[model samples]
Target: MADKRLAIVHVAYGAVGQRQNRRSLSFYFEPRSFNSHTHGRDSANKEPWTTRYGAQQDLGYTGPLSFSHFPYTRCLEDPSQLFDIAIIGFPFDTTTSYRPGARFGPFAIRSGSRRQHARGYTLTWGTSPYDLGAGLHDCGDVPLSAYDNAKAIDQMEAAYTTLLSRPVLGGTNEAYKSQTAAISLDGKEHPRIVTLGGDHTIVIHFDAHLDTWPPSGTTGQERITHGTFFAVAAEENLMTNTSIHAGIRCKMAGIQDVEHDDAVGFQVISTDDIDDYGINNIVKKIRQRIGNSPVYLSLDIDVVDPALAPATGTPETGGWTTREVKRIIRGLSGLNFVGADIVEVAPAYDSADVTGIAAADIVHDFLTMLQLAEPPVPHKGPFSLEDLKYP
Candidate 1:
């Protein structure tokens, strides 16, 4: 009986060894010699595939047509339409002071923002601008035909005036053709315009620089280059007296230029101020200055350090980091932001779309902050740092 049991054990062990030998031979199907480039689709197939003689090509197909694909929430085009916010692209960059190409800002920004709407919901704010009950729309770029600076400026202002109250398409309201009454939101009329830039110059009436100079050879409209739009905007009574300019790093003509800035109701904050007084204090001061008045937030891409944002025409050194600027802007939530803009994104100067991505994110934050007026959502519990890391 002992001899018979030993023979059976030996047979079982021999069978297991034969199975291991077969498993080892299986690697022959996937040779280690071939480079990835030379590896074809049939490399893993045991049976050889027949080669095709004709040229390999994919048949193209047409899809449904749409106006534009927005990175944020989108609405249908409606004339005389009142929404919480409207995105207007001002693609006229002919008036740049240092570098040109900001005319492409709106297009680049839109492209960058393509991924945002997918992740628009956030833990910090607990809601998105789309959920705030007010509607949002992307009014495509204003058809700015003028190459002349003054004519371009007039076109932008006229377009802005028309967009403020009426639809991008003509509306029925005769009174609202060039003027719009403020729409009520959160107990206040806060229908707003969020403009993508043609250049930093388009911020003319909106900031401290009225683009004034000390009488040079350039005369009349020529004098009003990109730097002087603010002066015209102020003269037109288009700007609110409580406006503020952030990230003013470039030199002015003199102290008088600054005086003119203050004279036109702008409280300027330089990138240097962020280092002097912390971001929180700067934000507090901004909130104090802006108060409950309707506000227009303008962000120039050059405001960021060139190391982080090198795509703008005017590359300034020692500027704010993207994180710092975002924190400052985010801190100003709950303020009545009636209009805003992210300007000076020249993609031709940009490498790897860094400037475009930053511009898109800034606009995303602006949109997010617009909805932060409501109460915060309760935290669910602890999440690890690794859990929140980017993909």
Candidate 2:
């Protein structure tokens, strides 16, 4: 059977209903590699990138329109329009303890994402979700002032708050929660908004900002609930909780000491410890903790090997392999998340723009797959490691 184990695991979402039946003829396409952005053309046979982009004078095409300009709106940056998912930027680099230029993250991510979208590097391809009907928009960087990070976070928060309520191209409302009426403009809730960042500190403060929403948006506060942002979000009493910290290794007193507190309510599979403990098991732990809820993913480029993302601020060594990171992302599929972001890319450090491109590709693949996966899992009992099949 050609060693079915790897076969089944490698498929682009071939399994459904039961694991055994997924042994169909396909098992080698990650959602990204599925080639959605082929723009309805064949992947391998489509025009070559350079020639298609008109960079190659040798294999030139003298068409009136340029292939490079096909996606036309690559750098389209602005907000105020609605998207089921919107990309907001927080360009602050001061919080980084090491390198000092993550502020350029949004631009790089945008550029990368644009390139991938132009090519066939995404599965969800277009902006609207086929399974759930959500609209997505790349509403570039959130307006921020360099000197005031807190104020910047507030502005970022306000931007997301706006996105979470705006009507998307006149589609159905995609509001995640509105218990406290956290974000209401003109008396209507917007779509679910995702935020890209300038740095990791944005995550901590965003975690803080989520507290404004009511727990479960139904009744009295239990003091700790999923409405929060941290993995201990419930413990912290914020919205959209359950955090999995990938590509990070630090023992700062403030963050690590809480691990001793069983009630801390958040779980992090730090890349340092996860690599030491074995990635597969860590993947199992991540699957266990997040379950099948609406999660919001935050990826700092430093989480990958510096070689893979050398342009990020606070570059960490021994980060996850590109495949390892991709696996983590895939494992999170079939999940309903509010949004995702990749930050800490400083193109100034890398003229080649490798990190930015990878970040863009990763984000695009995730967002695209999010739009392609089966609808929100039936809120049944949590799935276990046993749910996996290896034959």
Candidate 3:
């Protein structure tokens, strides 16, 4: 009787395996044919499979990795493919003084953006960047030499200049009509760039450090590390005096750093100013300083408190909160942003991708800032009265 029971169990298992095998064979050998519906054919008689059949969409976790999963294109190599806004990566970090992992910043930031999709919308901004009429594309990273800092800097500058020279692909929306004209420099409308930085040094202004240290004593090769690139930019006339630096809390060599920062054409906004002056006032100050001149906003990851965003080459202890930084960026929406970058996110130093997420969110804000034709009107909650009593 026991032998019969075991035999019965074996037969049951064998039958189940046979059924699975048959199902697998049927799936592989099933007759397949494409009909009009399957091929995306329509009554209008347009070419079948020519248009809607090949639509490419990516889920948050799956797809070719691009900034916000924007369609990848070699716009620099092929100028014929025009775009109003382009996301380019600068994967260079030899210039960084404190840390070396920022060279992987672009990849980390892109990975963090995996959650963002074309359909995603920001309630605060009230629009999806992809829905904006402007043509947006990921232009890939500018190839740079890791061994040569000077060569890399030149490559970056040249790449930026090339992109800046391209004509803007005007958007379809009426509100977006004026942006191209307003952001035009040299009497020609140019494409806006949102760069993924390898380090904080690539920025002209903003972050914990003033980043405007003069290269007085250093050799030509040593002159242009991440710490002093802004000074080099100032010398090269790459930045205007209207630029301003916010969230500065780095240990300065002396008062000369501030003086040099001023000379390099940046007004300083210290990290503590957020506590004293308030967020609205700080935004007002930034706008007042920038004044209508084409703005290039660059945010360093170290600008945020190290506790919240610790994956940066330089981590300053006391810095602005991520919320405060986002609020400030949101407030500055109406400014003419020609380009922007979020830099210095070293994933090796990150605990649980907090820094990378912050950087990606800021980049989302950057996109919104660039696409917005006007500053977003403040939201009034249901609890707010037309005339609320304040104690």
**Per-model C-alpha lDDT, please?**
0.62, 0.51, 0.77
| Runs with alpha carbons beyond 4 Å of true place in candidate 1 | 1-68, 71-83, 167-190, 200-221, 374-391
Let me know the TM-score candidate 2 reaches against the reference structure: 0.57
* Tens-place lDDT digits, model 3, residues 24-79: 44433333331233344233334444473665557788988888888788776887
| Greater-TM-score candidate between 1 and 2 | 1
lDDT of 2 by residue, 267-355 (tens): 45566665578766765676666665546666666667877778865555666776677655655555555566666678888757788
For model 1 the TM-score comes to: 0.66
Clash tally, candidates in order: 6, 17, 0
TM-score of each: 0.66, 0.57, 0.82
Candidate 1 lDDT tens digits, 1-391: 1221111123455577787664434434434442244456335533433353344422221121111234232222344455556788888777666788888888888767666654677775666655554456676777776557667777777866665644333333222222223323334233467788775411212222334342232255355555665655677676667777776777665788878777666777777788899887888878878776656577777778888888887676878898888777778776655567878788898888888878888887777666565234444667777888998
State the weakest 10-residue window (summed lDDT) of model 2: 201-210
lDDT of 2 at 144: 81
Clash count, candidate 1: 6
Error of 2 at 255 (Å): 9.9
- What candidate 2 gets wrong by more than 4 Å, as runs, is 1-80, 121-134, 170-190, 201-236, 239-242, 251-263, 272-281, 374-391
Clashing pairs in 3: none
